[model samples]
Target: MTPSNQRCSVAIIGGGAAGITAAAVLRKRAPQLSVTIVEPSSTHDYQPAWTLVGAGEYDVATTRRRLKAVLPAGVSLIQQRAHSFEPTSNRVQLEDGSILEYEQLIVAAGLQTNWQLIDGLVDTLGKNGVCSNYSYDTAPYTWECVQGMQNGRALFTQPPMPIKCPGAPQKILYMAADHFKRKGRKVELGFCNAGPAIFGVPFYAKALMQVVKHYGIATHFGYNLVAVNGPGKEAVFETTVDGMKIRHIEKFDMLHVTPPQSAPDFIKNSPLADAAGFVAVNKHSLQSTLFPNVFALGDCAGTANSKTAAAVRAQAPIMVSNLLALRMGSALSAQYDGYASCPLTTSVGKIILAEFGYDGVVMPSFAADPRKPARRYWHLKKRFLPWLYWNQMLMGNTGPDWHAKREYPDTLPSISP
Candidate 1:
């Protein structure tokens, strides 16, 4: 059967947080422009809540909704994977041999979590106390592993950078440590990270080190998890000392692995990609460097912002605004300041909401000391944020009402548990 070519005013790739939000915004601002979303997944996940799910503080089912249920009205959905992009022709090729021609294109296809890059990981996952909060099936198992452990070594591994939610790998670790604390059990906890620091931002890292000391957890920087032997309860890591590569093996009763991630291979090999295999775009405008009509945002764009849904929230409005400017044949006026937020859950009821812009400048939405762990932020993470995410952000409410504001720090009193 031959699939006929379809044309539209705009085509959006990927249906995750970024794509759906963009479609909604486009539909609201430009009702006449035909907008189509190219996505293959039937389910959309609120991924930021996965850490809570892994900590037993949340139900995983609440983090998901059917794709059709959340998409904005009047926006078209193409339930197919994008095979490749042909920017010169302003068309996207789908896996089913159908072609979509568009006056403007936006690529929001997110990064790929390559679990297979770690040897023996695929076979061992979801068993032998091996788990990850990164996947839907294994997140619940992480809570299982945390609850079942009595007093043996529990290892949490964080791979190299450019991974989504850079603070997530440690968020679950904190949850497990807090869980063990409540039981009066001391699990020999270790954080094996490929990076040299606890976090990218210095202000937040200084505060996180205090939490690390509070837990008495061992920190091994420059160590990357490379393989797992589930049955034997062993994990292998590669690191360097004195400019020499070395292998370190550790045995554990429980292991939470955050896998290495990268741009999807299709995007990496495409002509739209930059040197590092991400969509080449102007950092501020998010307009493709090669094609004027094409734009990109989210994890797939070669931008310096931290890869988190909060970043997508800030980028969404800017991307849509600039995209419309392009359509008008006017200069792009909107710019994304590389804003990203990570609500670092330090305990079941406390979170340090770290929000920053380019060069790690603190850009707290509220003027409170972002360094302090607070109960309100936890509720924001657990209660308010999720509702806002579904009802507001994803629905294209990107005006001043939707913007995050910085208030006076001293005015907001901190609450203690």
Candidate 2:
């Protein structure tokens, strides 16, 4: 069974931001340890750019690179999809029926887009005015729809809880409104969200409401999209509060759907997953609760953090440090506070960067007031974030905290919504 390749100290299951960063950190900390990353796709996508792409600001190719180009130089690459896991044998089962055993494991196979969950959505998406920002191919379709329409209900839906980038639903809505405003063709915009609040954090919620007011976006909280009649240009939304009385059917010229998302099915069904579905790991260490040798990060883990690339940068080193701590027989001292960032793009040039930690705590890294919308934060998001993401974070150079030394003003002022 063991015919070709040599065993590695760590086997990474996905080559996305979390998987790649984990590999980079592991190699940096333990140069002698063998590491390999198994990923199926050759194209590496910077998913944060999806927003800009939909806004007609960036193209799809601008956010992508060859997968091999970003991987650590010395690490072996297995360009294959993991079909299943055999944790009992410490082996990963690939689609080609090959076996790769390892000393430790890290699974970062990010969220899956369940486009088929809504009726007729699968056949109609990326065509016929039914588009989504979640897909790389369909992001431009959103812009095309925006450019093509001036009237009619432009419906944007946020699926149920636990989707990646929770604020993404609202972000797209604001951007779309801005596009219409700039074109001088005002369109009726409706936000149908599954949650009751615009945002999890109250400080940012206040700021978002102002943008909503300026753009005249109608909010229908507690509304979840259940069906899509794309050919007929209609979307069905069910009310969470009043299931029977509030069922509403509306026709739309454009629909921007943030599809329902979840941890990869294989990882969720395995022993590593907890009851609710997600790799069961200690929130602080990012290590498997049952098996100490296994670790998980990104959208796949049960860490009580918002899933974003910004969070992955904060999580990678902690997971790496803990894994190395195990190899060196040292007590694990590093901890992750569920730090995650969401750059809420309210306009083409402005962003309300919401940085928070465990339990939705607003942990701003910059000293500027959290309530005020400043150009500096937007500049950081536009100018510095990509550099920090590709050069510093993915390169395994982000130091711990990157936030610990920051001091935001508490006395400047506070805004309540």
Best by TM-score: 1
lDDT measured at residue 284 in model 2 versus the true structure, 0 to 100: 96
Q: What would you estimate as the lDDT of candidate 2?
A: 0.83
Predicted structure 2, TM vs. truth: 0.94
What 10-residue stretch in candidate 2 is worst by lDDT? 408-417
Overall local distance difference test of candidate 1: 0.91
After superposing candidate 2, which stretches have Cα over 4 Å from the reference? 1-6, 242-246, 399-401, 404-417
TM-score of each: 0.96, 0.94
- Residue pairs with colliding backbones in model 1 are 367-409
What are the per-residue Cα lDDT tens digits for candidate 2 across 1-417? 643543678999999999988988888888898898999999888888887788887778878888888998799989888888888888888877788898999999998878878878888898778888897888989889888887878999998878888988887788789788888986999999888888887767767877788888899888889888888998988884534646789889899998988777888778888876888999999999988889999998888799899899899988999988988899878999888889888777777778888876778777666666555666777667777778877778875455532445444343321
lDDT of each: 0.91, 0.83
The best candidate in terms of lDDT: 1
Model 1 bad stretches (over 4 Å): 399-417
lDDT of 2 at 340: 89
Error of 2 at 158 (Å): 0.5
